[model samples]
Target: MQRTKVKELLAGAEEGKEVLLKGWVRTKRGNKYVTFIAVNDGSTIHNLQVVAEADKFSEEALKDVTTGAAVAITGELVASQGKGQAFEVQATRIEVLGKADPETYPLQKKAHSLEFLREIAHLRFRTNTFGAVFRVRNTLAFAVHKFFNEKGFVYMHTPIVTASDAEGAGEMFRVTTLDPINPPRNEDGSVNYAEDFFGKATNLTVSGQLEGELAAMAFSDIYTFGPTFRAENSNTTRHLAEFWMIEPEMAFYDLQMNADLAEEFIKYIIRYALENNRDDIAFLGQRLEEEDKSKPQQDRQEMSLLEKLEFVVNNDFERVTYTEAIEILVNSNHYKKKKFQYEVSWGVDLQSEHERYLVEKHFKKPVIVTDYPKDIKAFYMRLNDDGKTVAAMDILAPGIGEIVGGSQREERLEILVERMKGVGIHEEDLWWYLDTRRFGGCPHAGFGLGFERMVQFVTGMGNIRDVIPFPRTPQNAEF
Candidate 1:
């Protein structure tokens, strides 16, 4: 009596056995004698075909079995005579659980543009492309936890609301419960945050690395995976207003150890996805190939999606210092010809173009650039002996620039206090963060990996908005 998922039925559920299956109809086609219905329950990329005899079910009884309609069918499993699939269901009775009017259902038996699919994101999951993308995303997320758990890392849940800016970028979403039109004000006409919900200023956390550090101090090794928000108004294919981050803090890790762990961690997750979700990933690779055909030959990716994943997993990432990377960029033909839009200098931050050049053109592999200029990096990164560069590192992939960023944290209280003062972060605002260094600080290092960026990398999705379920962007928050 219970309904079996289409996946199970297709995965060799005993043939000739009567079974009940339920799913949404992906497509329905037939002549006067019979109807072939493709049903998919999102268990896998492929759909299960159900054959209904014209004599058994009259046209009136099967009127509601249209595309996008939810249906339950009681049938006998048998070997499929179809060329592509292995097995199918021969329906004896079909019930329309939810009827989708054929005249109004938006999803028809045709290809739709990715831009148009974004408009109907709520229903996009039913499409093959989105279904494949989300399945691979699910695999990657689970693989992240699994990799950390196997390494004895505790999964710590950090607060969503915080008073300190971890990145110090000053692009955080303010969380307030005060009236916007007319509210309490100070003597200088400034908005009073003392009476606010937290009794002081607070906003959605930009990164959980600070709080994650507190837990790492005690737990020895900890990681935080959660949502972070930014109020930046930039609209780009790579930027997202709200995104997820995976930050892992270790009590006694140096820059080298941090880089080693990051390398292992990235490979582990990618290997897991390739092992567990090959079908879904293969589908995405094909989708990318189709999309890339429209692009010019020069803009097309050098390697396919599967090839890129395998390359990252099997190869070692070339490691270089920020100085060396800058030197390489400065001497390259790309830089000599004045092709780089942003200037390439030792003290300046590396742009996406520079990062991509280092990975895709120079190294032809993933690269880890380390020891960045102290002025361009965050205040928390430990200052090197030269006092001009910080012990920071960023992992740059062929397609995605700067997939991971981390550094050895400043453990000396005196130095940390001086760095905080230099950056204008008051000692009072981050007293707790300082407490880690004040009391029992040792050499500690950690790094943050943008979860959506990882998804974008693994899935080969061009737009950052396509990977996340509900993208929150400037002037657009539609479902």
Candidate 2:
């Protein structure tokens, strides 16, 4: 017999039809005559309620059907006598595929703290909260590819290892095969990278934008979605040693065009979730509401989950220059009250508090702050005619500070070389990249969307680690 997914079975499957279902037990309740079991197949957050007769399936076999127990149930569909759900399955035979000891299972019938769940991440997917989050995550990822494909953008797979630093952040995980305790060295006593596997220094890629730009020159428009690594030692919730990034590069695009594409891309995905993953989103929203109940009124979010998602989809993001944003922040009540931990200055990088203030309080919407000082931005960012600011933009969301960061690339060879040199980036290392300008370069622009951050914003998840399965942070690599 073909097995039916819990989602399809719950969604108006013909009653009185025999069905085979397989799932892990979420919870089980029983009396003298009958036993009730709630099962989830990872198809949706809602579980399929199953009713079984105590005499039919022996108590010994039924005892194996507890929380976290995997089972295969052959049953008949019928209207549920219960309150919350519409349909329930009356099982004729119950087979325990796998048994989880009720005494040792980390997840129980009652609510478990998120921190505790993280410790048992290998089993976290079985929980309702994570199940809903990952389903919405799947839809959002597909929506990203769909949005780009519909816009005639080619999907480019950039290499995961490279010699150049795209963002010049200098935080990278080195890839080598040399002995760590004792390795080959040059006459100068420095480690000889020539003796290494790659024959020179190499590291995991931090961004795909640079390579995506090369593809864009020929393809006209290209996007790369792949894993990027940053070896920062910071253990904050916002930082991840390894994460996914989405970068789209286009020829003949300026700063405004890049921002336009980013805004459209964001809205299209959120709207996709609202349409396709409505059930999961609603479940997550309700979960957030339950979590928010313990917070003070002043600390609560201004909008509900659906309301916040709709607001971004419906409204145009407020666009401002870095200079203008600084002025607004300095004169704002937070800065005036000395509540901001980081100083709000014209050239300083905007901190979480500053960015959140602009989006949540000052603008009360998504804000795209552009034209940052060249000193604070990457060498690849296009230098504006003002000779001070680069054509860069950071999109700040109401909850997450900066979800996307991108800039228009420098096209002129001399200027590109100068910018690279000014930043102490040797031209010999980026000869191929400089060749783009040397041969035939046109005005180009691109932006990077942090995949985890977007997931965090869409799902209303506070910690970045919760949004992604198998999060990689400093000193932690547990499954």
Candidate 3:
């Protein structure tokens, strides 16, 4: 007989019916007559209970089978009498598939620090917290596909290696075929990269927006969801060397419409994960309660992820221009108590602290800060009528400072070419981008959302490194 999922077995199956199960022993307790064991098959965090009489299976047989040991069993399904579970199994045959050394296994009955878990990433998925997180991660990815697919968006795969540095921060991980120790030297004493692989020079893509714009021109609506690399050395909770980003490029769309789509997309993902994995969310909530009684009441809110998402999806996003946001921050009563490091001014870029205050304290909801000063935004953003601000918008949530960054592209060929010059970007470097505007261009807009940041925000995870499997950070790249 085929093995049943642990979760399915727990839902009160046929009593006295033969069943086969395979899993790792999570916990075990026994008396003289029989032994009770909890087995989990990696399908879900919840485990199935198995009862075996002393005569049926030797007590010494599994005495050494501690936690994390893999096993299989043939048993009779029966309704559980325990308060913790609704159903269980009565084992007639047992098989030890894999043995885990009790001394070597990192996981124990007690809780382990998140730092400790990071070191053992390969085995972290077996832990309940990580299992729940990755499950939600998988569902969120599917949700992205579902949302874009239904809206007539073409999924495009942009090049992983490119010549353009999208962020213009000069933090690219250089990819070269030549040796660095004694590399080819140009007559000017600089590195000669005429013979480099991919020729000239190349690096891993920081963002797909540039190429994505080319796709949007052809497909009208296109989105690229893939891994993006950054070589920034900052060791913040938010920064990572390698992370996934979602760039949605839309032709004939303005900044406002782009912001609206981003809001809706975020809500849709949270809703999908909640609806599909309600049990896991509930389990986490309960587990958290048992672990930390002093956690904030809002954290314990029984509002299902779907319900919270519904509230966001059905309602209009609170929108405020950058100028208005600065005014609120400058005049808000709460500002009196705290000393802000960076001054909030008309032309200043909003820091994470200010962003947090705006979303968490002022609006108490997701807010879109739009029309930022041109000096602070990217060169591609469309210049607004004010002659100082760009048609850009950033979606800020309560805890996550900026979840999405987007702007309306400069469509006028002359204006775009001029803006490129103003930003000190060479006309030759962005010739193709300029050609797009010269030949066929419509007012386009899009956003780049850090996928790990989104996961961290939705799951209330503190660190970006925790969300991505095998995270690559400065001085911290271990498989």
Give lDDT per model, in order. 0.93, 0.92, 0.84
Cα deviation at 292, candidate 3, in Å, is 6.5
User: Where is model 2 more than 4 Å wrong at Cα?
Assistant: none
What are the TM-scores, per candidate, against the unseen true structure? 0.98, 0.99, 0.94
Query: Which whole-number lDDT from 0 to 100 does residue 87 have in model 2?
Result: 93
Model 1: ten consecutive residues of lowest lDDT: 6-15
Writing each residue's lDDT as its tens digit, candidate 1 over 365-428 gives: 9999999999999999999999999999999988879999999999989998999999899998
Q: List the residue pairs that clash in candidate 3.
A: none
What is the lDDT for 203 in model 3? 93
lDDT of 2 by residue, 396-434 (tens): 998889999999999999999999989899999999898
Q: Candidate 1: misplaced stretches above 4 Å?
A: none
Ranking by lDDT: 1, 2, 3
Clashing pairs in 1: none
Residues 80-101, candidate 3: write the lDDT tens digits: 8778887889888888899888
Q: Report the lDDT of model 1 for residue 114.
A: 84
Model 3 local distance difference test score: 0.84
Q: Candidate 3 — worst ten consecutive residues by lDDT sum? A: 300-309
